[model samples]
Target chain A: MRPIRAKLTQLMIFGVLLSMLAGCSYLNPKPLKPWDRDVLARPEMQLDADSMEDLMDTKIYFSKEASRGGANIGGGGCGCN
Target chain B: MQLKQTGRLGPALAAATCTLLSGQGAQAAETEQVDVTSLQYREVDRVNVDEEVIALKRKGKDEKRFSLKLYHDTITGASPNGAYFPSDTYTSPSGSSYSSTLAPITDERYAVSADWEREDSRRQKTQYGLAYSIELDYDSLGANWSRSRDSQNRMRTYSYGYGFNYDVIHAEGGNPVGLAPATDTTRSNQDNKLLFDFLGGVSQVLNRQGVFQLNYGLSLSNGYLSDPYKFISIDNDAVVDNLLYEKRPDTRLGHSLYARVIYNIDDNVLKGSYRYYIDDWGILSHTLDMRYRYKLNNDFYLQPHFRHYSQRAADFYSIVFYDAPAASTYEYASADYRLGNLDSLTLGLQAGTRIGKRTDLSLRYEILRQTDRLGEFPSLNASILQLSFRYTAK
Candidate 1:
């Protein structure tokens, strides 16, 4: 992959160009509807999906790698790799 | 979960009728209503959050006079350190030494939070909050404070936190598995670290259903960052079975970015979010979360969610690692999953009915299943049930 700066620059340029070059658009923002929010508004549909699932996944992920940061802000006693 | 997840489709399709029956466009709101919503969650000793919020407005005004929320939670659960199937049987890239299976552990935790917010009709809003948490056994307490503002075209939020932590195994105790010289007792053993965190974000409402937010967070921590139970394994077959235990680097820096989007629908809403994370240890991660909510009617709904996560192992990661495997296997651990892949799915059902004109209750159930990227790794699944009752005397 290119450097981080390159990726950021590309995104900025894309956003600027997209804003300046919009012709007739069919994807305009629409009004909010109850039916549409039916799925998105549910608590079960929150970012983590299920806490139990996230907990299990977090344990698995933490044990398997050096990277750890997402839901919470701490680590605990562990002898595993 | 898959079957129930599939069953949810039936209601979603049935809810399609709502779009045709209801009028289009946002509905008008009534003036002067006091609305309060709250949830108290408990997870034994693993995780718990009690969040109660109340919003009050005058009889006929565009401004929200006041809002308050109080949260308290206690978390307790058995977290697995690492799992190993026999040496030949387990072939993870990182490698694990002990061909063993250990029972899970229950770590205790408690947390509390309170917040107040206000917004004048001018559309400007301000919010302030305070939070605290303590993890028993390991003996750690976390304190935090936050503030934010919001309006029409632009929104901004800023927050800061401080924490003090201590580990008994690190400072006072001798090497639990006394075997050799301890050059690395400093980072892994007993610890006192102060934590500082800061977050700043900007948000823009691109229309009704579309919103974009960007955030940057910096965290500085001292003390130990290693897992007392997490050990590394070395390849010397003899000592491999009896892995050594070691600590990880004490301090590190972390930075990340987050973005989310929601699309409005007549009866079905679509939402997606992504987060990118990186730290000093050369580990990078990306997470994508998507959910679709389907409304069956005014009293019913079904939702499905999917998630994908990936990350590389830490620099000192390994399956069969002996702390400082290269120098002297001081710690015992197999980096078997130190850097594993994760994929999950969730399906839920929500049904609500009113006991009277002013009291409403809802029942919800969700099933989640997770699998590791390494085809050989184990898979775990869970089921949860939620019951909520609300009473309003407007």
Candidate 2:
């Protein structure tokens, strides 16, 4: 029952985001300039894209687990977590 | 005591996890004009008893690249037996037994990939590359291409990618379990092997408060997907023929979804991620991870990360011997943890800073422990310490 709820919560949030993405437009942000690089250049601000710290945690998490790389695990095995 | 201890780790863990995931109590760095690149090298010596591995990556600038990886899952060597633990022994905590033997491995991986990228502008970029690897008689060659477009000040982005891997598997070894003699070099039979992955996703700044990204991927594989080298234990019974072993599923179609969200408060950053996966091979998995990164000062910061992951083993998973006649010809061990309901708790710390005027370095230590969490469970513990250094020409 708990897992079912968690799964449902995931689906709901994901669904809402999908709809917004589809209907998105540049004006979502107020009066923008043509050459604005603030949003695009904010590397520290990236959501899914991993930063150095994120990658390190990911590698450790990945190394320690029995599962495949999740997205890709074609590489060799390492005893290191 | 055992039940009380395990139960205690639950809610406190969940609350802490939620706090981290929701991205609170952390500060975000104010941007400064600076360029950064990072590199890592790891040589694991646990060999056969473990698989040895080495990797290097450099990302930043206008181009990003990384390389090399090896997985000797079916590694040949002697194991503590006490570690990977065979089935049964739940009658009591100390009921299990162990022995040492010169064992052979069934799973192996040797792969490498190099990719290059080019930016058409701040809003558009393209990437393409090729990679190849071989395990046992199985070899794979593949290529991928991706395109990303930005909007809303790059606060939001969309990307799509597709790739294909053609694999070739050949049977080897005289041992039915797929182990070769200390001196046998015979290369045996061949079978069709192939896998495919397709991905699409979007990333967005949810608010001044945080950012979120989601991806949906499809994978199709036709060929040998079984673990010829893995084994399962039957219910507490050390029986005849040591319980027959089966191969992994042949054709598996799978889908994966994952997301990452980050929140900032002045000098602290909170990051979170969740992943959901399902495959036609009768496997489903879920993962949740979170971290709090705080800048202690200009040249240093302290970041502590915690993660929780859980998965349901493939339908064929077994705790041990099943009613033989009911098992499928392609049966695999319920003990094949790679296919079981697994939950992992990770605790980590990352600390580092800029050296002189043009050098940067950081150190990281992460610890992870896995639990079967099935009706009965087994544990495999692992840890890592990473030191990374980067310098750009002054």
The DockQ values of the predictions, listed in order, are: 0.14, 0.16
Whole-model lDDT per candidate: 0.44, 0.52
lDDT of 1 by residue, B197-281 (tens): 5555544444544444445555665655545554444444345444445445567676656566655567466777676776655
Q: Return the lDDT, model 1, position B59.
A: 23
Worst 10 residues of 2 chain B by lDDT: B28-37
Model 1 chain A — which ten-residue stretch has the worst lDDT?
Answer: A20-29
Give the per-residue lDDT digits (tens) of candidate 2, residues B146-225: 78898746566788887777766554542233222123344336655676778788777655656666677777878655
Model 2, TM vs. native: 0.68
> What's the distance in Å from true for residue A50, model 2?
4.9
Q: Pick by lDDT: which candidate is best?
A: 2
lDDT of 1 by residue, A1-81 (tens): 336744664475356335423411322344444455444445433443333334333544453344444344332322222
